[model samples]
Target: MGIVIIGSLNMDMVVRTSRAPEAGETLFGQAFALSPGGKGANQAAAAARLGAEVTMIGRVGKDGFGRELLEVMRQEGVHTDYIGQSETQATGVASIVVDEEGENRIIVVPGANLEMGREDIAALEPVIRQAEMVVMQLETDLSMCEQAASMAHSHGIPVILNPAPARVLTDELLQHVAYLTPNETEAGILAGMAVNSIADAEQAARLLLQKGVENIIVTLGSKGALIVNHAGSRHIPGFPVQAVDTVAAGDSFNGALAYQLTSGKTLTEAVRFANAVGALAVGKQGAIPSLPQLAEVEQFLKESARP
Candidate 1:
C-alpha cells in the first residue's frame, strides 16, 4: 500500500464574504459551495491526485453525506473499503467562511469521526500493516490517532502526523510519529513559544523534537517550511502563488511530502515538492477541489524551475 490515512471525513459548507462576521453581526455572502473535506480525506485525495495509491480508514454517518463522501473518495481513486459507517452519529461537517483575501475561518463538527474506536482500528489492522506509510490528523479522537500511530510504529512503518486544530500532544504520540507536520501556530503551541518567523519556528521545532518526534516540519504558509531533525534544521522556501483559498494547503503539503518521500526523494526534496503542491492547492478553492493532479504538479514544478 502506498499511503494509509486514518482520520476524519466531513462535508464542508463554505460561504464567501468580504470577511468574517463580527459577534452577532451577519453579512451577505458572495457565494457558497459544499465540498468534501476532513484532514485525513484531504491528504488521501491530495496524494492520490499526485499519483499515489492511497487508502482511507475512518467513519461517516449512514447518511447521504457519508455516501457522497465515500463516492468522492472512490472518484479520487482512494481505497475506501476500510471506511466505517456510524449507526448513531451523523456525518461530520465543517462550516467555513472565505474572505476576499482568500483567508478562511472554519468550525468543524466531528460527529461520526469521533465514533472511530480501538475496535475499529483492530479490525483495520491488516490494512494498516500493509501500508508503506501512514498519514493521520487530529480531527478524529485523540486516542484513535495515538493507537494508529503506535500500531504503525511497531511495524516499522513511517507515520506522518498532522497535529491540526492546534493541541499540545503527549510524548507517547509524538514518539511514534516519524514526521510531525505542524503549522506555525501549532508549532508554537506544541513548544510553548510564539512562532512568528523562521527563527521562532526553528526554536519551536527543536523543542518539539525533544518530545521524541523523529522530525518536525513547520509549515510557514507563504514563507515555506522548516525541516528539523536530529541533525538540526533548514528552511525550504515556499513557491509563491495567487492564493484564492488557503484551505487544504497544509494537507496538500503533507500528502505530497509522503508521496515523494515514499518514492525515494530526500526529505529536503520532498518538502520542496510539497511546497509546490501547497502552492497549487492555495490557488484554487475548497479542499479536494484545490488539489492538483501529477501532471499539473509536474508542469508547475517544471515552470517554477525556470530562470
Candidate 2:
C-alpha cells in the first residue's frame, strides 16, 4: 500500500536577504524566486521521489498556480486525482525570507487550503483506509486534520502528523497520531517548554508521549533529530552539510521517514534515513526542487560512509 497525504498546497515566493527585516521596516533583498511548496505538497513529492507510491488529497484554487501545482505533483509521481479545485479562493501562498545562513521566516496565506472540509475527508475514506500510512500537517484546517486522523485511526491505519507552523493540539487530535514529528520550536509549543537542546527535546517528547501520542520525533536542525517512545529514546546525529536553503528540510525528513517506516525499516533506522534526506535538501535550494530521489539519497549515504 502507498502513503496518503491530506494537507495544503501552496506556491512560495522566496526572498534572500542578509537578515529578516524588522517589523514595520522595509529593506532591499539580495534575490527572489518562486517555487512549489507547502508542508503537505513538499512531503508528498519528497516521498514520491524516494520511490513511494503517494496520493495527495487537498485543495487548490482554480488558477494558474493551482494548475502548475498539480503539474509538479504529477511530474514527481504523486497521485493528484484527489486534489480538488476551489472556485472562490485563490491557491495558498507562502511568502518566505531566507537569510544567508539558510534560516527562514515565513507567512502562509492559506487561501484554498482552508476550503478543505470534513466532507472531503469522509469522501476520501476508501483512499485513506487502504493506505499504508496517512500523513498530514497544520497547514490545512485543524478540523480537516482532526477528521483525517480520526478516519485513519478507525481503519487501523498509522497516522504521521508533522505539526509544522505549530499550534496547540487538542487531546482528541493527539489520540490518533501514531507518530508526531515536531521541530524544536513546535516541540516547545506542544510540550510547554523551551526546546533548545537534545535534553530539552527529550523532555518535550516525553510530555507528548504522556498526552497519548505513540511516538515523538523532535527535529533539531543541523544538530539532528530525537525520537522517543515506550521503549526508550535515541538521538540520531545529523550529517553536517553547508546549507543553501533550509526551506523544506523538515518536510524532506518527514517524507523520507514515512516512506522508510512503511517499507519495513525500524523507527530508528527510518529516522537515520530521514536525516540523510534532510541533509541533502538543505544543501540545495527550493522545496520540491530540492527533494532527492532514491538513487541520489543512496549514493549520498554511500559517499558519506567513506573513510
Candidate 3:
C-alpha cells in the first residue's frame, strides 16, 4: 500500500536570531529565507525522499506561494493530484525564528488550510482506501483530520497521527490512530502529565495507550525518541551532529518512521532509522531542503555502523 498524507502546505519565512525575542522586545535577525513548509508538506517531502510513494492531500491558494509550493512538491516526486487551490484565501504561511542554540519558534497563519472540510476528505476516499498507511498532522482543520482518520479506519488502513502543536484530542480521534507521534510537549498535553525525561515520557506514553492509542512514539530531541508498544518501551538514542537548524526535525522523524514501518520493519528498527534521519535533518539548513535522501540515509547508517 502507498502512503497518503492528509495535511497542510505553507510558505515558511524563517529568520535567524541570537536568541528568542523577549515579550514586547524586538530583535534584529542575522539572516532570513523563504521556503516551502507546513508540517504536512515537510513530512510528505521527507517520506518521498526516503523512497515512499507519497500522495499529499491538502489545499493551497491562488497565490505565488501556492504555485511555488506545488512546484516544489512536484520536484520532490510527491503526488499532488488531491492538492487544491482556493480563490477565497491565500495559502498558509509560517513565520519562524532559529536561535543560536538550534532551537526554533514559529507562528502559523492557517489560511486555506483551515478551510479544508469533510468534502475534501470524502473526495480522497478512494486513494485513502488503497494506502498502507495514512499520516496526518494538526496543521489542518481538526474536523478534516477526524474525517480522514475515520475513513482510513473504515478501510482497515493504519492511521498515524502526529499530534503536533498539541491540543486536547478526543477519544474518538485516539481510537482511530494506530500510531501517535508526539514531541515531549505534545505528549504532556495529551497525557495530562509532565514529561521531562525518558521515565516521565514512558509514563505519559502509557497514559496515552490507555486512552486508546494503539502505540505511541515520543520525540525527545537530542535525547532521541521513546518508542512504546504493548510489549515494552525503548529509547532510541540520536546521532550526534553539529546542528545548524532544528526546524522540521520532528516532521522528518515522523515521516521516516512511517516509511520504514510501511516497509515491514519492526517499530524499534523504524525508530532507530528515523533517529538517524532526524539527526541528519537538524545538522543542515532549511525545512524541506534539509531532508536527506534514502541513499544519503543509508550511507550515513553504514558509516555509523562501523567502529
Candidate 4:
C-alpha cells in the first residue's frame, strides 16, 4: 500500500544569510536558491524517494510554478494524478531565510493550496482509501485536514497528522489522528504551554492525549523526540550531523516516519529512521533537493549505527 498526502504544495524561495534581520533592520544575503517545497509536497517527495508509492492530493495554480511543481513530483515518482490546478490563483510559495547556524525563518503564502476543501477530498476519496497511511499538515484549510483524517480513520486506515505551522486543533481532529507529530514549538502551542525542555514536551504530549490523540511525538531539535502514548514515554535521541539548512528536516522526518510505519516498522524503529532522515536533510541546502533517497538513508543508518 501507498501513502496519500493531502496538503499544500509550494515553490520555496530561499536566501542564505549570516543571520536573519531584526525589526526595521536590513542585511545582505550570501546566496539565493529556488526549489520545490511545501510541507505536503516535501513529505510526498521524501516518502516517494524512500521507496513509498506516494499520491499527492492538493491544489496548485495553472501557472509556471504549478507546472514545475508537478514535474518535480513526477521526477520523484510521486503520483500526481489527484493534484488539482486552480484557474484563479497562482501556485503557493514559501519565502525562507537560513542563517549561518542553519536555523531558519519562513513566511508562506498559501495561494492555490488554500483551494483544497471538501470537494477536493471527495474527488480523492478512492485514492485516500487505497493508501495505507494518510499524511497532512496545516498549510491548507484545517477543515480539509479534518475531513481527510476523518475519512481515513473511518476506513480503519492510519492517519498521521504533522501539526506544523501550529494552530489550535479540535478534539474531533485529534480523535482521528493515529499519530500526532509536532515539534516542540507546535506541541507547546497545542498544549497551551511553553515547551523549553523534554519534561515540558511530555506534559504537552499528555495534554494532547487527553484531547484524544492516540500517540504523540514531540520533535526536540538536537535533543531528539519524545514519543508518548498510554504505554509510556521514551526519548528517541537525534542523529548529529553538520547543519546546512533545517528547512526540510521536519518534513523529511514526517515522510520517513510515515513510510517506515506503513512498511511495518515498529514505532521506535520508525522514529529512529525518521531521525536519520532529518539529520541528513539538514546536512544539505534547499527543500526537496535535500531529501535523502532510500539508499542514502540506508547507508547513513549503517554508518551511524552503534556497535
Candidate 5:
C-alpha cells in the first residue's frame, strides 16, 4: 500500500551559524544554501527515496519556486497529480538558521499552502482511499489537515499526524489519528504535562492514547524516540553520529515510519527503522537533499550494527 502526504512545499533558505541569536543580537552565519523543502514534500521525498510509492496533496504558487518544487518531487518519484497551483499567491517560503549545535529556528511564510481548501482535499479522495497510510503535518491549513484526517479515517486508512509547529488539536481530530508523532515540546502541549524524560514521554503518550489515538511516538532528539502503544513503551536509542544540519531529521523519521507501517511492520519495529533513518538524516546537511535513500539507510545501519 502507498503513503499519501498532505502538507506544504516550500523553497527553504538556510544559514548555518555558530550559535542562535539572542532576542536582539546579530549573529554571523558561516554558510548558506537554498533547498527544495516543506514538511509534506520533505516527508514524501524521504518515503519515496526509501522505496515507498508516495502521493502528495498540497498547493504551490504559479512561480519559479513552485515549478521547481513540483519538478523536485517528480524527480524523487512522488506522485503529484493532486498538487495544484494557486494563481493568487507564490509558493511557500522558509527562512531557517541552524546553530553549531544542529538546532534550528525557522520562520515560514505560507503562501499557496494557506490557499489549500476543502475542494483541494476533496479532489484527492480517490488517492487517499487507496492508500494504507495518510501522513499529515501542521504546516498546512488546519481545516485541510482535519479534513484529510477525517477523509482517510472514513476510508479505514490509518492517519498519522506529525504535530510539528505544535497547535491545539481537538478531541474530534485526535479520535481519527492512528498515530500521533510529536517532539518533546509538542508532547507537553498535547499532554498538558511536562515531558522531560522517557518516563515523562511515556506518561504523555499514554495521555494522548487516552484521547483516542491508537499510538504515540515522542521524538527526544539525541535521546532517540519513545514509542508507546497499548502493549507498553520503549525508548529506541538514536544512532551515534555527528550532526551537521538537523533540518529534516523529524520529517525523515515520519516518512520512514509511514513507509514501514504500510509495509506491515509492527509499530515498534517501524519506530526502530525510523529511529535509524532519523539518525542518518542528522549526519548530513540540508533538507530534501539530505534525506537518506533505502540503500543509504541500510548501509548506515550495517555499519552501526550493535552487539
Candidate 6:
C-alpha cells in the first residue's frame, strides 16, 4: 500500500576483524555472527519499523535460509505474500567483514535472487500498480529492475531506485527512475567520473541528471548527503554518531526516505529523517537488528542535536 520493494534477501555471514587481510595473507578474525540481511529486506524492515506499509517481492531458495528470510520480514511487518522460492538455487548469502572503524567489505553470491525473472514481475503486476511508490536496487537481475520500473512508471507510480553494489546502468533504465539514490562511489561509476569530494559529486550528479533521472541523492556517509535535480543541488549534513558497525546503514536511509516521502514529507525533510535512521543503524550490530524502530528515531531526534 505504501511502498513495494523488489530486491534481494540474503543471510549475512559477518566476521569482525581488527583489519582485513592483505591479498593472500590470512588473518585471525575477532568475532562472527549470522543475521538476516540483503538490501531489500533491510529496506523493507526499515520502512516497516517507521510505520510504513511495506510489500516485498523477490526470490529466495527453497531452504532454511529462505524460511528465515520470510520469518524476519514477517516479524518486521513487511508483506512477503508474493515472494517466490527457487527450487534449484540456494538462498542468497553475503559474506561480510567489518573492521574496527565500523567500515565493512561485502561480497554477495546472489543465488535465488538472480533466478527471479520476468514471470515473477508479471505475476506481481497488480501489486506494482497498487503501490504508492515502488523501490528497487541492483542486487537482483538488472532486467527485473528494468521490467518493474517500466511497469510502475507506466502506471504513474513514482519509483525510487537505489543503485548499490555499484555498477554501470543503462540510460534506458534511468529514464523510469523518479528518484535515484546512490553513494559517492556508485555516483562516480554511473557518471563516468571519479567522485573524490563533494564538488566531484556535484559534477557527477549533473552528468547523472542528463540520464533522465528526476532526482539524484548521493549519500556521503558521515559527512551527509547531496541532492541534485532540475531545481539545483544542495547538501544536507548528517548527524554525528559513534558508529560501531556500519552494515545496513544506507539501506536504513533508503527505507526511511521512502517512508517519509510516502508520509508526505518534502525531499529535504525525508533525507534528514533518513540520515537519522542511518545514524542509528550504525551504533548497533548486524543488519535488521541495527534498524531502529520509530520510537527510537523520534527520541534520538529529540535528544541529539542535528549536525
TM-score, candidate number 4: 0.98
Q: In lDDT terms, how accurate is model 4? A: 0.93
lDDT, candidate 5, 1-307, per-residue tens: 4898999999999999999888989978899888999999999999999999999999999999999999999999999988999989999999999999898899999999999987778887888899889999999999888888999999899999999889899988999999899999999999898888889889989989988998899998888899888888888888777888899999999999999998889887898889889988888889998899899888878887857
lDDT of 6: 0.94
Which digits, one per residue and each the tens of the lDDT, describe model 3 over residues 150-172?
Answer: 99999999999999889999999
Off by over 4 Å in 2: none
lDDT of each: 0.93, 0.94, 0.93, 0.93, 0.91, 0.94
Kindly report which residue pairs in candidate 5 clash with one another. none
User: How high is the lDDT of residue 276 in model 4?
Assistant: 92
Return the TM-score for each candidate structure.
0.99, 0.98, 0.98, 0.98, 0.97, 0.98
Error of 3 at 261 (Å): 1.1
Q: Please, what are the lDDT tens digits per residue for candidate 4 over residues 127-160?
A: 8888899999999999888988999999988999
Model 4 segments more than 4 A misplaced: none
What tens-digit string does per-residue lDDT give for candidate 6 at 139-185?
A: 99998889999999999999999999888888989999999999999
Off by over 4 Å in 6: none
lDDT of 2 by residue, 116-160 (tens): 889878998999989999999999999888989999999999999
Worst 10 residues of 1 by lDDT: 117-126
Positional deviation of residue 199's Cα in model 1 after best superposition, in angstroms: 0.5
lDDT of 2: 0.94
